[model samples]
Target: MAPGVGGAITGAAAGKFFSWLLESERARPPRVFVSFDFDNDQQLKHLLIGQTKRQNLPFSVVDGSLKEAAPEPRWKEAALKEIRRCDVVVVLVGRYTYKAPGVLAEIAMARSEGKPVVQLIGSRSLGYTRVKGAGKVLAWTQDNLTKLFGND
Candidate 1:
């Protein structure tokens, strides 16, 4: 075989190998617990969630859009349970997040459970306040999402 042909075959084989590796990494979508101030940040949270779904990102939000109809104590219990099941927690930090007791509690629970926490600050106007146990605090963007969840 010609040397150029041999080099081409080798390059094709390497490309195929890397492609397979990337696919394998994407196969197991991580379970994510998203903690946000539902009352104040719902729209932004929904937008992020929608983008993830539309883009077929490599992660699943364990907490669906279900409202917490239960009382505060029971709701916290349920939220903690969901957080425990997830591999990571994404906290949507907005201006009202510090004032939202439930959001703070969720972040605390995630920390107690040893789940990795990724904080997504919705706006610069909100002023960034790092969550107690956040592993990363980043602006809301697809590139930041990729940083947390890996390239899709």
Candidate 2:
């Protein structure tokens, strides 16, 4: 093959590959609502979100972090709005999760909105206390996440 023709073929192949990547990203699963105790589970939340992004996972977080400056009602409303937009909710159940009213309320909102709930136990020894409408209580693992939201 002529050198110019070979170069043209390679360029076209690269373009097609990148186009497919973009389309795959756009076709990923709906945003996920993450419910957790902001004070206690923030690190775990960040770790999970970071890992998903680092590995190019097929899910995006709905940013349920409440502004501490906002009033309680405002925070609740904001969280509910996010939950309504999400396809599924993942409750990060840390040791203090049961004591967090906001986390519990977020889970309730997800349930009321008919969003599927997955309770991710942050600590293996903590023992899972099933969230009201959670369909599964899974340990925090990339494989589990992939199982719930298949790789795109």
Candidate 3:
């Protein structure tokens, strides 16, 4: 090997090195798209949004969640666009989440886009239902959230 030639990463090696750096343990915080039963779970969504401002959370909630009670036509299209830009979709499961057409539609959109979905138990009610097919409903804990978004 020529002197100093082996000292630097170049070409394919450089590309690989860069990739490794990006995928390393210190990868950027995952962008999260939050979904919830807007009719009854707005406060829960806001609670999660508040966590983004803290430095200890593992993910950053992306803006552009639908805030209106009555979505205009093509709202799903807008939702899908936002979902596509995020790393994961977090559905805040609530009492009426299953009955929330918008939440269900958002979940379907996330699934169709191949985005990972994380279901968090956002309600303390006795019969708060989970969003079907969204996988397990996990507790609202920093540890669990970190495990999901920490290195992804």
| The candidate that achieves the highest TM-score relative to the unseen native structure | 3
lDDT over C-alpha atoms for residue 5 of model 3 = 75
Tens digit of lDDT per residue, candidate 1, span 23-71?
8866777788888887888876787778887996767777643474567
lDDT of each: 0.79, 0.81, 0.82
What digit string (tens of lDDT, one per residue) describes model 3 on residues 14-108?
88888898777357788889888777888888888887676578778986566674555567878889999998999988888877888888888
Off by over 4 Å in 2: 1-26, 125-128
Itemize residue pairs with steric clashes in candidate 2: none
Runs in model 1 deviating more than 4 A are 1-27, 64-69, 125-128
Off by over 4 Å in 3: 1-14, 17-26, 70-72
Model 2 compared with the native: what TM-score?
0.74
TM-scores, all candidates, are 0.73, 0.74, 0.81
> Could you tell which candidate, 2 or 3, scores higher by TM-score?
3
Query: What CA root-mean-square deviation does each model show from the true structure?
Result: 8.4, 8.8, 4.1
What TM-score should be assigned to candidate 3? 0.81
